[model samples]
Target: MRGRDRFALPILRRARRDATLTRPAVSILLPVRDEGRFLGETLASLSAQTYADFEAIVVDDGSRDASAAIAEAHARDDSRFRVVRAQRAGMVAALERGRAEAEGAFIARMDGDDVALPGRLETQLEALESEGLTACGGRIAYFPRRLVGDGGRRYERWINGLVTPEAAALDVFVECPLPHPALVVRADALAAAGGYRDCGWPEDYDLVLGLWRRGARFRNVEEVVLRWREHPDRASRTDPVFAQGAFVSCKVDHLRRSLLVGWESVVVWGAGPVGKAFARELTKHGTAVAGFVDVDPRKIGRRLYGAPVVGVEAAARFACSFALGAVAREEGRQQVRDVAAAQGRREGVDFIAVA
Candidate 1:
């Protein structure tokens, strides 16, 4: 593990109490902190799930507001709602607490500020059981569309396009391939992967990567099932741990551990900013960069970070067993992949597109 323990299962502090609880078909692990304004509406969405055989395990992670009271209000009328006081633990710990308190065969994720579309649970449960997937999520839409930025919209598109296990796996190196709040995962599969952990980056992304590395089958429902609320205080946008550098560090660490092991050198395709940045991260993780490959006449002969920039043909001749295509544009990535394929480079085995 590069940062905190990867998939380290924590001992649930409330397991003894949870054992006597009624078991539901699905457990929604929702961790809320200072989300009083949105907690009630979020709870209502869960309460309205067409599949009624589900329980919402809401963990209050030391909220300074009425979030707990809001959750309590819902629990009073809905037997499916249970609130766990997590004092001051962060989101990852709170999620672990929620999982410990969960008594269902499947686990679903939700945020205090998000809304689940109608039939979200029923659709996911059916897909899970019918397709025999270890975990599955659905397409997501950012609410108050005007609040969403260009980057967020692009990310939403890229993530939702990964609708199969292979697609998700292929893009796992680039970024989190599934929407965390829209996922329904098999309980046993989750346990087998050691549940969630404080991985110093995005905890949801770390869990998804862990599960994918464990060979978990993943898929996404074609329809939108989650209304992802966007705001200035959103974790990803404000949390230092979810910063761009943290994500890049986490990805490089995982790739070094799982995929780049035993590889001495790699040819970076695309000498642009994205490619050079990824190359630097990979180097910091002890992987040697053979050089950069690019088609630009201006860059082909230059040296970046002490590595020579070569044309596509020269890159194919480099003394490296693997290559990482870090181009950001779709057309550029396709061109890079075509060049690699022409050179007999294989995806997953010999190369991967990181952009």
Candidate 2:
């Protein structure tokens, strides 16, 4: 099966029949696979959106359970809702398909197991329209409090702190500053940036980086917009594509194309695992690691990956064009930033923070 044939025939026919309907202001691209247990709740949240001028394209990616049927039932009741049945295509393909069917000026993303707060659509739309941002996201709160872990709490706090555009841009390389499901983007900008791709890493991160590369401005509404669900079956937890190594590769690839361009060699701060791993990837990408800067007295003067590990004081001696703060700890990253600033090196120009 290919293209339209991969979709349920009746659904496609209905979609074509409704082509004359008024185009919605926003299109929600939701992909579902075996999410029957939580699909209903997710759909209900969409129904509760205060911004009513939107269409929901629920792509049922070959759900073996009642996921497709549940979506169909919702479509039957709400004219704004429609379901597209796909043949087990992965998340990226499903999102692409939804994008193809979307008829809105803005495209918002939602997951089958997540809940969007009532004001999510309206607030994000206003931010994009009023502020002229290409893409917008909002803070996320993980649901089912019992399932929330230490890592989840920390991520929530870090991401929520990125209320301003500058904060998001500053720490984008450190981690995906925007929560994927809470994101809304201008349709034209999303298209220009090349929709979504499965680049052997998390698709959401790849999309954000791609938009950034295209000079798209991003902002986060300073409010919680989505109640993100955390479960053992979440792709980030179960998929190899979301692993630590994959993310490192993704970051390095984008860095090479953007910030790392024209720079022959770069210095890495932090001689720990995070720094060493990033240095190794940079070397593989043909970017030389000039040296590693560390605060530990034991590590200073030692050699790593054939590059000298120097103390912060000796960091200025290296002739590297750029530096990467590759420390994992938040405090450590801040210290790296402080040191870089004290050395008269400007952030975003002289160095970038990464994990």
Candidate 3:
């Protein structure tokens, strides 16, 4: 009872907590790396939450500096806040440890380097309630506005413009488009999926795509809830394990394991780079790829690396289980799924996952 068990109890006690301090239930989650520089401001943002009745839980992933001390300081002053230490595991493992200690009905995620807008929690909770969203994220505003370079600005615009929850399921190729550090999710849903599995470095995106496959609902609040901080040393920028190729690998592996399990022949859509790469990867794992599908008439009837590039029409001939969306665009992925459906292929069973 010294660790996770000691913390999970509040979830059971939440309903009976004092009405004076608690509001609608939530657990604010933070997994800190070497974030000593920004912890104070992050805690400031949490302390300002308009929606109360939540615990601020942080896990220090064996930082060599003041990260643990900063978190401990906050915990010392604020009974609602607690800090715990974990092995130098990756972000996903740290998130899992922190979530196990979460005592709220709803889990709200935040990054140690980012600041939440004053109404961030309230707005996300409201959207989660109204949308009946198991997972709800919101718009983001970039901080140190001058620090937002070209690539960061592009990501900001792209993520902020995602209008629908289906956008997550349909167009995940654009990276973890879910508003990082700004979403709130159902605690049970988080636990049901085994919290978060530390796999690829882009654990946030992996979790988002995973939840989509597991049938958890995600909603994007129209209002901005997080002030995303851009820095030269951001984990996505510094970590090679979080690269584009890594993202493609993560999506493909998850689809294969979950939806395409036990299939004799697997069809990969898109004859371009991603599809070809996926075919190469599957070959490494001894999975037989039936063929490739593409809308490119130039590549049609052509053989790339000995695999025939047939039009989408070829899907009817094979007993392939899933027509994986190998395309990069949202519209392109949908078109492939729609064509397969028209040909009597099911969504998850017959085909699944956008590149």
Candidate 4:
């Protein structure tokens, strides 16, 4: 036993032991806050799951509206559904509380506003077991079709495109490939990854990155399992915690801890705003910027943040241990990959796509 196997053995044993217990095979942690309008629909979806042997733990985080009552109603109607009341703690605190009360081999996440497809749990569990994934999610379709914006459609396509663990890992830094509401994770893996935290960024992204750091594999099933609701009151739309700057900060922090470890300097493969912002955060974490790589002729031969902006042809001359592809556009990111490969640099080894 060595490497990940050494860490994974205990989790596997724990899964086996938990399976033998009289508990539900899956525990769905649903954190609700003033989701009165949509709670009933979400609960109904959960009740309709093809895999019926699961408990839905609804954590009501001090909702002034009828959210708690709605959940209580569901609890009364369905024996497997239970409502836990907590006073005004945020989402992370609610998740932590739900996790503490979970008694299943696998822990699934659900949002009070999202609708889980009938086969969501059954499919995710099968993938987790068959593929040996630490956590698994599936494709999501944003509902109220007319309300879903261009960005939402793009994001939906991008997330649904990544079905394999390798595809998810390669683009993990670009965005959270796993839809939080669609996730079903191994209880032991979640516990080993330290559950959820109020990390000043999106908790879902933080947890995914933390799991990746611990050598946990992730995947997305090839079918749509969640009808993700898009509305004005959604936290991602209003919360500063899910802001672009916060996401960038989180990515750079994890990048510093993982790929940039022991490296004194790195070369950013874009001189645009995206690359500059990433480099700025990386610098704050004590990593020096060797240079910025750019294809634009005008931007080349300039200096930004005390680092020279050089053309792609001259980027390899920079004295840096690793290269971060921080281009914002997908086409630009792919271009970075092509250029890096031409320079004899490997994607995950010598370079990484950060945009």
Candidate 5:
């Protein structure tokens, strides 16, 4: 964490206590990197949004293609559409530029390649204003390759199905609960997180954690707002920007910040991939692990990843944070939680889901 200035802090303070926008004005911010082919469709979706009191700020991130040309064309027709050109190639840097130039009271993040539904702005605004949530993203649908069989398809379905606040708690345990490309957030809250950082993969997940750390609520409207295109050329699908490993690293980085207690040893609750990954990140951050606990008889009483794998019973002897790294399988997690609970480990304060 870094120090914040009065300029940013004051706005955040006001937004925290005063998020009551009956008819909140919005600033639609889009960051583009060679999104020429479908930039028009994206802009058209924004144009069709039911919400009326908003302007578009498109940050052209040094596009080699005609992305800027589309922006110029859109600006020709509507004065509300604005373009900010970034000389560099950093996405976070581009987002920061857009934030600095935004004039909307509420902030909405959209990608230049993704399409927004006609009611996207209205529904997101409605939920944001009514609930006063600092962060909100609607259900996201994957278009074109909607019938594909890759795990990304399952990911899309799982993500789109999870929209409510409660579901976010569960879904975030897997990956980022709110779809990054589909979210609408309060400007003040964004300013509080020092804008967005290129911290790690799943920048959106990192941003969500930063916002949550600042005491902002995370939410999602059940209604689908954005059509996330699953093209091979997309940054998330192609570059290392939002890969699985990056997502894990990002989650652990932020999780260590918020969840790690000072010098307190952590008890990792699995010996599988997720468990080893969490242990590695925890160790990298200099957070000591009391030991690793597992139910697999073969893993028990053996050293895994240079850490002793202890039986579930051994956990009772240590007072430490338990990192539940079980993913997709909740029964084992529930059992681990049950064992921890029986030993008097409290949720949020003692045990945390790290998958």
Candidate 6:
């Protein structure tokens, strides 16, 4: 199955039923497979949205559980609910199916296991319609404190703090800048970007990078609009497509395609684990890293993965062309920025911080 072809005839017929109701202004494409335990809560959250001018297109992706029944129950109860069935296809196909059937001007993404705060739709729709942003996401809070890991907490904090496109763009290569479930995108823009595709990486992140490469502006709603749930079975924790190395490969591929196309030699800042990992991926894809820059005296003279590690001064004088800062911490990123500036490098032009 590919693109809109993923939706079967029956599913298509089910999706197109209007019932004389007004066409929804926003379409929520939520795909679930075997999520019976959590689907009801998610559907209820959507039904409770402050903005009622939306339709929730819940695609059941071959669930062998009560997931479909739960969705059907909700559809019977609410006129805004539309359920489509799929046969074990992954997220990208399910999303495309929902998009093809969507009649709304905007598309909002939701997962079967997450909860949407009451005002999420209202706030995001207003922001997109009024600000003319290509795509926008909101803050998220992960629930069940005991299940939330340290990494998740840090990510939440970092993403919530990024309110502007510039701030998000600076670290876009480091990780996915926006949470997928909390995002609202212009339907036409998404269609123009070729909808979603599985590029051997996380679908959501790839879409975001693709949109950004097309010069799409982004922003955050500055409000916690979604309650993200953390569990061991979540796709990010279980799917190979979302593995650490896959993310690195995805970033490297996108960087080469979008930002690093004409650049020949590049300087990598930060000789730590994060920096070395990214540098390795870049080198694997034929991007030459001139050297690594570090603040640590011990690491400064050492060689990391065969690349020379040097002091900030040496890195600054290494005939810089383009630099990628791989530091993961805020302070370290700032330090890299300062050193790059001292070398007369301009950000978003001469240099971009990866993490």
Instruction: Tell me the spans in candidate 3 whose CA falls farther than 4 Å from its real position.
Output: 1-24, 145-151, 172-174, 261-263, 295-302, 311-321, 329-353
Estimate TM-scores for all models: 0.91, 0.93, 0.79, 0.93, 0.86, 0.92
Residues 182-273 of candidate 1: C-alpha lDDT, one tens digit per residue: 98998998898789878788888787878877878898888899999998888878888888778887778778867787888888888988
Of the pair 3 and 6, which is ahead by TM-score? 6
Off by over 4 Å in 1: 1-22
The positional error of residue 9 in candidate 2, measured at the CA in angstroms, is 39
State the RMSD for candidate 6.
6.6
Instruction: Give the per-residue lDDT digits (tens) of candidate 5, residues 58-118.
Output: 9999999999989989877766678887885678888888888886777888998899988
* lDDT of the structure predicted as candidate 4: 0.88
lDDT, candidate 5, equals 0.74
By lDDT: ranked, best first = 2, 4, 6, 1, 3, 5
Question: What lDDT score is found at residue 304 in candidate 3?
Answer: 65
Question: Candidate 5, which ten residues in sequence have the lowest lDDT sum?
Answer: 1-10
lDDT of each: 0.83, 0.88, 0.75, 0.88, 0.74, 0.85
lDDT string for model 4 (1-355, tens) is 3324433433342222223346887899999999999999999999888777788899999999999999998888787888999999899999999999999999999999999998787778778876789998899999999999998998998899999899999999999989999989899989988889898999999999989988888989998999999999999999888999999988988888788887878999999988999888988878899999998999999999999998877876964569999987788899899999999888877799987
lDDT, candidate 3, 1-355, per-residue tens: 2323333333344332343365437887898889999889999888777655678889899988799998898877767788888889878778888877777889889988999987786677666766667788888889898988877786777778775777655555446768768878888887776677777547777777677768877767888888988888788788877787787778667666676677876777788887887787776677778788888899999876567788876767664445776776656766777787788877656776465
- Estimate candidate 1's alpha-carbon lDDT, on a 0 to 1 scale: 0.83
Task: List clashing residue pairs in candidate 5.
Answer: none
lDDT (C-alpha) at residue 47 in model 1 = 81
Clashing pairs in model 4, backbone N/Cα/C closer than 3 A: none
Residue 108 lDDT (model 3): 86
lDDT of 4 at 127: 80
Error of 4 at 343 (Å): 0.7
Better of 1 and 5 by TM-score: 1
- In every candidate, how many clashes are there? 0, 0, 0, 0, 0, 0
Q: Across residues 259-354, which tens digit of lDDT does each residue of candidate 2 receive?
A: 988898999988999999999999997999999999899999999999999887788887566999999978889999998989888888879999
